[model samples]
Target: MYPQVLFQNRKPDRIATLEEYRKSGGYEAITESLKNRSHKDIQEILLESDLLGRGGAAFPAGRKIMTVSDDAPYPRYVICNADEMEPGTFKDRVLIHADPHMLIEGMLIAGYAARAEKGIIFIRPEYENAARILEREIGLAEEAGFLGENILGSDYSFSIDVHRSGGRYICGEVTAQLNALEGKRPNPKQPPPYPTEKGLWGKPTVTQNVETLCCMPHILRNGAQWFKDLALTEAGAGTKIYCVSGKVNRPGCYELPMGVKLSEIIEEHAGGMKNGAEFKACLPGGASTRFLSREHYHIPMDFNSLREAGHRLGTAAIMVFDEDTCMVAATLNLLEFFARESCGWCTPCREGVPYLKDLMWRIEHGQGEEKFLSMLRKQSKYLWISYCAFAPGAMSPVEGLLNDFEDEVMAHIRQKRCPFKGGE
Candidate 1:
């Protein structure tokens, strides 16, 4: 177990009501921010804390706050990106469901800092309970003078709308999310005029993940140094909600410090492997991240540590695979999801993902030849030509297959069938 800043005191088997959350000293950050602090002050604190985005990319959240154009003709917008579509990623779902007001209060502080009058919670439709909880909490906040006109009798005013996503993985991408929110076809638009510059309806917008925003209130209440000291690593700040699944005795989300070792998370936190199963490899983060072998288990699970080890801390969703799991079959299963979720906007992602999936399926089913293996490897390399991160992320499992599990895949080819057939 590690620090539980996010989940501490959370009620088991029940969603935290607005009253309960408020009673627990919630909304104090936004109240202090609006009544006494300015946007620049908030931004400076965040910058000092070095809190990276909790979304897959791990970008700096404060940098996004500072870059919004206040002089833009249109009102700036803030979006709470709750589109948790990445496979094995459900921490956001838990956050929204248990402590919806945490996200709401966090958004209020974010909107205040960005000078954003309008905000949107872009929640995935699949998370019906979380969406409902958030919607109800937004109303409660409005009635309590935390949202809508003249918040806390001050000049600052902000309102939030919860929008159910159209159920595409692409919508998790900020630009594509803006497009979908604007009632356009969901697709990733090229960057340069990034969301901070020109976003929803061509207005400057700040989009942050649900967990990233949830950290805002704590940073405000505890101060930047306190937040920085909470991390176990030099650069890492705050706690990470690790969603552990697959072959683990404890298959659920655990809030751990940033630099907690992977081995601790897998063995101690996840209660070791289920039924004494030997850990073969893990996605470490979500499906998009590169796999980490048991040898890397002693390393810290921070952004820099994982990246230094040639992997990403994607959404911090740890998916462990036991020894009996077939690497080739697992790779194919992930590719099939990517192929189905492709937005079909560009040829590389639209066509390439499905083609890769087909190749992997053939190889998994024992129809693979040397050329098919070569094509799988080559296609994984070139899928980066796609419009957005989708295709490249789709190829992550393939990357793991080629790099760490090549012998496992070779066994499939040699056996002329998956070695672990009928045994995922």
Candidate 2:
């Protein structure tokens, strides 16, 4: 069994109360920070810890903190991004249900480090229960003096608010979420003045996903070296909350050490493929990431390892598939999601995603031609030219299907029918 850090107190039923959290050294980091640490001190420790954002992007948390200038204007905002809308991902919801205080404590510490007095948990509509849990727990924390107005006998004060928000897949993006908070149309904005420099009512803002923030209390409580030592790989810093699904015996979240082998996760942790299913391929991350073929089955499920292998550790939401699954149909299903959830801000995504979806639709329904494959290959490249990462992300499984499973695709084209489905 791997050492549990984030899920240490995870209960089978009900939430861990404030008292329970306190007993397990929750919020101790805030005390330690107030008494002994400075902004630079916190920044340096975070940098040294090398805590990558667990929110799929893997951006360095320290760099984001450092970007918020120390002399930046007052009313700086720190946002806890709880919009866990990525398909096949639900780690955030699980984390909140297990222990909500960890997120609150993380926000407090982050707010102090960022010199922001206000913290907002920007949650999605689907997570109604998770949002309520956070709201109730936040009030409890305030009553105990962990939040609002000169916290814990110190000059530092931090307050958190839960912003139950409009649902959109694109709003999960930082800039888009900020815009949504301001009651504007949610759209991804390019960084010149990044969110850390200017955001949310034009004030300096620091935004982080729930899983990333949840790691803060633990990182600050343990020293940087201790945090680094938690990973199985030198390149990794901490354990990953892997959300496993599809064809697996235990389709749930497991907080395993970073850089654990994909085989180990599927075999030892996830109880292997379900009901004697033979593994064909898997979307190693969320729906947005490219598929990992059977050849890479033994690959280490880490950011560096996956990147080096021309893949991503996207949300770590491994969607496994059995041999019976059709690659073309699977890609089409993913495209259907991209088509519907598209923000329609840019041409490539607004038009390109649906066009691809249409092509995939025809192909699956036996209207595909030999020329359609090359046409797809040609147009899919344009998705990268879009305004945001969405188009590019949506193209992942398609690229994988074309790149790794061209034989399967050719089978469909030659037969004028899906190989897995009997049709003329």
Winner by lDDT:
2
lDDT of 2 at 97: 97
lDDT tens per residue, model 2, 44-115 = 888899999988899999888889997899899999888888899999999999989999998987888898
lDDT (tens digit, per residue) of candidate 1 on 72-136 = 65588999999999999999988887888889888988888889899999989988888878778
- Clash numbers, per candidate: 0, 0
lDDT value, residue 171 of candidate 1: 93
| Pairs of colliding residues, candidate 2 | none
Query: What TM-score does each of the candidates earn?
Result: 0.98, 0.98
Candidate closest to the true structure, highest TM-score: 2
